[model samples]
Target chain A: MSLDKATVAHVAKLARIRVEESDLEPMAAELNNIMTWIEQLNEVDTDGVQPMTSVVESVLRQRSDDITDGGYADKVTQNAPASEASYFVVPKVVE
Target chain B: MNDFASRIIQGATGDWEMVIGLEVHAQVISNAKLFSGAATAFGAEPNSQVSLVDAAMPGMLPVINEKCVEQAVRTGLGLKARINTFSVFDRKNYFYPDLPQGYQISQYLQPVVGEGIITIDLPDGESREIGITRLHLEQDAGKSLHDQDPNSTYIDLNRSGVALMEIVSEPDMRSPEEAGAYLRKLRTILRYLGTCDGNMEEGSMRADVNVSVRRPGEEFGTRCEIKNVNSIRFVQQAIVYEAQRQVDILEEGGSIDQETRLFDANTGVTRSMRSKEEAHDYRYFPDPDLLPLTFTQEWVDSLMDTLPELPDAKKQRFIDDLGLPAYDAGVLVAEKETADFYEQVAEGRDAKIAANWVMGEFFSALNASSGDITQPPVSAGNLGGLIDLITDGTISGRIAKQVFEAMVESGKDAGTIVEEKGLKQVSDTGAIEAQVDEILAANGDKVEEYRGGKDKLFGFFVGQVMKATQGKANPKVVNEILRKKLDG
Candidate 1:
C-alpha cells in the first residue's frame, strides 16, 4: 500500500505530532517505500497457514490479582514536565 | 410481546421508533490494576495508586491479571454467551490527557466473549431478550480533572490500566425503558457474579448509549453514540433525547450525521461532541507485548462451576420452590444482596411470610433509612426471629410491627424487644375470655347488634379486646373468644 501526503499528515495529526507541511511529501514517500518493502512478503503463497501473534510460542503470563505495587506517587510523577499534587498536568481537554 | 407499546415519537410528518444499544464498561472487581500491581481502589489520592506500568513509563511491560480474565469469562457464562477459547488483545491507539499510554489495550476483532443474550423485564410485566453482541476486556484510562486549574487539566493515573469489561449489546432495545431495564439486568448479573460491583454512581459501571430513529419496520437510521452516561436513569434520558433529536432532524428533511454526543444531566439533553472526536481512526492492531490468550474448555467449565446462582435462576426458584408471586420474586432477586438476605430470612421458615416481611416492612425500613440490604438495620437472623414470633403465635402481626419499629429504634433483637416492651401476644384462653366478657358487658347494645345479624361489629369487638390487652392479644384467639361469647 502506498501512502499519500494527506494520509501521512492525518496519521501525524492523530499521533499528536506536529509534522511540518513541507516534510509531508518526503515522509509519505518514505512510508510508501517501507510499505512496498513489507509488501514483498505478500507474494509468498502462505495460504492455509495460521497467522502467528508472536515469535515465541508462549501464552501470555498472568499475575494474580494482588496489590503488590504503588504508593510511590512521588516517584511516579517525578519526571513529569508539569505535575501538581501527584497529578500530571496537561492542557485542558474538555471534550 | 404483549405489553410493548413501541416507544415511538409522533413527529409532525410520521411516527418514529427508537432503537437503542448500550455498551457498558464495568470495572472488574480485582485488587490490582489490569496489567500492573497497583491498587485499584476508588477515591484514592490523585496518583497514589499509580504504578510505573500504569503511568506508561518507558520500557515497562504489562502482564495480564488472571482474576480479570476469569471475571470476563464468568460474566460471559452468566450472560449465556460464547466464551472464545482464544482471544487477542489489541492496541486502540488514541491521544488524550487521561490516556497516558497513548493507546488503550483492548479487544477489537477477537473479543474474549462472543454473542450472548440477556433478558430484560419491562415495567409492563413483560420480558424481552436483548442480544449481547460481545464482551471484551480493556484497560481504563485515568481520571481527568479539567476544572482543577484555569488552563490545564489534572491527570490521575490511578484508574489507568484498570481492567474493564465492555459489554456491548445488539440494537435490540426499542424503548428508553428497555435500555434502562437492560442496564439494570446486566448490573444485577455482574453483581451476582462478583465480577464487578456494578455501582454506576461510584464509576464502577458506566454506559455508552447508541440511539437511532427509524420508521416503523423500516431500515435502521444513522445512529449517534452518547458517551459516558454514568447512571441508568441518565442512559434512558439520553436515549429519549437523542432519539427525538434524530427524529426531528429526519422530519425536517435533513440527514443525520453519525457523531459522538454528550448527555447533559442538568439540561436532560444531548449535544454533539467536538468534531475531532468523531473521526476516530483507532488503527487497531494486535498487542505484541502480550501473546494471545488461550484456555481449555475444562478451565471454562471449572469457572462455570464457581458461578453463583444468577438473578434469573434465583428469581425462578423463588417462584417455583417458594411459591412467591412473580412480582415479589422479581423485586427480591433484583439485587444479589437482597436475594441473599431474603434467603437467610426464609431459611426454615414459611417462605411467603418471610417474603412478605422482607418485601414489605424490611424494604420499607431500609429505604427510609437510605440503607441497603448489605448492611440492613436488622440482621437476617433477627428478621427471621421477628417473623417467627408471628408464626409461632408469640406475637400478633400487628404487635410484631410495633416490635420491629422498636428494634429499628434500638438495636435489639425481636425477643428482647418483645420482653422489654411486653409486646408478647396474649394467647391465654382465660385472659382473652375475660377481656371479651368485659367488652361485651360494657358494649351491651353493640353485642346485641352483633348477635342480631350485625356481623360487621365483630371486628369492633375484636379491636376492643385487642385494645384492652394493649394490642398484644392473639388475633385468632381474640376472634375465637369473641365468637364464642357473642355469636354463640
Candidate 2:
C-alpha cells in the first residue's frame, strides 16, 4: 500500500510522534523502499511452503490452573522513579 | 470435497470466500518482566515496576528470559503448532514515547513457533478448524497517560518489557459470532494451559482484530486491523462495525483499503489510523547481540508431559463422568480454577447436587461477598457437608439455605452448625404425626371446612404444623401427613 506525504503526516500526528518536515521526504522514501522489499517475496516459490508461524512444534505445557499469588511486589516497586505509599506518582496536573 | 465448503460457497455467490484471521497477544504470567528482572505485577503504581532495561536506558541490552521462551514453546504445543528448532529475535523499528526502545523486540521473518490449528466449537455441537499462523514472544510497550494531562503526556513503563506471546490465528472465521467464539475458546485454552492469564481488563491479554468483507465467492478483500481491543465485548463491536464499514466501501464502488484502524470504545466505530505496512517497514533482521534460541527435544517432551487436562477434555469429563448438562459443564470448565474447585467439592459427593450448589448458592454467596472461588468464605469441604445434610434429609432445602448462611457467617461446618443451632428438619414420622394431630385439633373449624370441600384450608393446617416445628419440619412429610388427616 502506498502512503502519500499528506497521509504519512496525518498518521504521524495520530501516533503522537513529532516528525520533522524535512524528514517526511525521507520517511516516505523509506516506506516505499520497505514495500518494494516485501514485494520481492512474491517471486519465491511458496506454493507448498507453509507460512512459518511459531518456532517450536509441540503441545502446550500447562500448570494445574490453580490461582496463586504472582509473588513480587517490593522488587517490582524498586524501579520506580517516583513513589509514595507503594505507588508510582507522576507530576500533578490539576490545580 | 466436503459438503461444508460447498454449502458456504453456495450460500454466498461467485468464487469469493470469506477469509478470517486473528492475532492474540497474551501476557505471560511471570514474576518479572521479560527482558528485565523487574517485577511483573499488575495494578501497581504506574511506572513503579520499570527497570533500567524497561526504561530503555542507554547501556542496557536485553537478555532473553529462558522461561518466556519455554512458555512460548509450551503454548505452541498447546495449539499443536510447529516449534522452530531455531528461532531468532528481530528489532522491529517503531517510534513511540511509550516504547522506550527505539524498536520492539519481536519475531518477524522467523517466529518461535509455526503453523498449527485450533478447533473452535460453534454454537451447536459442531466445530470449525481455524488455522494457526504463528506464536511469537515479544516485549510489551508502556502505557500513555492521555486522560491525566491535557497539554503534556506521561509514560508508565510498568508493562514495558513484560513477556507476551502473540498467538496469531488464521483468517478462518466467517462471522462475527465465530470470531467471538474463537477468542473465547482461545482464552479458555490459554487459561487451561496456564501459558497466559487472559485478563483483558488488566490489559494482560488483547486482540488485534483483522477484518475484511468480500463477495460470497471472490478473492479476499483489502483487510483492516483494529488494534488492541482489550475486552471480548469490544472485539465483537469492533468487528461488526469494521465489517460493515468495509462492506459499505465495496458497495459504493470504492475498494477496501488495507490499513490499521483504532476501535473507539466511546464512539463504537473504527477510525483509520495508518496504512498497514509490510515486514520490511520495520527493517526486521536478526538481533546481532542475542543468540538464536534453541531448545532440546527432551525439554519439549517433558513440558508436554506436564500438560493438564485442557478445556475440551475437561468439558467432556464433566459430561461423561459427572453427568452434568453440557451448558453447565461448559460454564464451570470455562476457567480452570473454578473447574478445579468444583472437582474438589464433587469428589465423593453427588455431581449434580454439587454442581447445583456451586452454580447456585455457592456462586451467589461469593458474588454477594464480592469474593471469587479462590478466596471463598465457604471451603469445598464445608460445602460438601452442607450438601450431605440436604441429601441425607437432615435438613430441608429451606433449612439447608439457613444453615448455609450460618456456615458463611460463622465459618463453621454444616454438621457442627446444624447441631449447635438446631437447624435440622424434623423428619421423624412420629414427631411429624404428633404435630399434625395438634394442628388439626387446634384448628378444628378450619379442619372441618377443609374436609367440607374447602380444600384451600389445607395450606393453613400445613402452615400451623410448620410453625409448631419452628420452621424446621420437613415440608414434604408435613404435606403427606396433613393430606392423609384431612381425607380421613
Q: What is the lDDT of residue B218 in candidate 1?
A: 94
Assess the local accuracy of residue A5 in candidate 1 as a C-alpha lDDT between 0 and 100: 92
Candidate 1 runs further than 4 Å off: B1-6, B448-453
DockQ, 0 to 1 scale, candidate 2: 0.08
lDDT of candidate 1? 0.90
What are the per-residue Cα lDDT tens digits for candidate 1 across B202-229? 8999999999899999999999999999
lDDT, candidate 2, B1-488, per-residue tens: 11222222222223334455779999987777777777777867765677677777678767666677777888888888898877778888766656777788888888989999877776675778889999999999887665655554566677888889998988888876677778888888888888788889988889999987677766778888888898888887777777766656665578876788899999889997754443225667676546667778888899889888888889999999889998889888878889999999998899998999999989999988956778887999899889989888899888888888998899999999989988889988899999999888888888778778988887888888888898899999999888787895
What DockQ do you compute for every candidate structure? Answer: 0.79, 0.08
Weakest ten-residue segment in model 1 chain B by summed lDDT: B1-10
Q: Which regions in candidate 2 have their CA more than 4 angstroms from the true location?
A: A1-95, B1-20, B43-52, B55-59, B119-128, B275-280, B438-470, B479-488
Which predicted model would earn the best TM-score? 1
Candidate 2 lDDT, tens digit per residue, A1-95? Answer: 78778877876864558999998888988998898889898888888786553566643232232222223334544655754444334554221
TM-score of chain B taken alone, every candidate: 0.96, 0.87
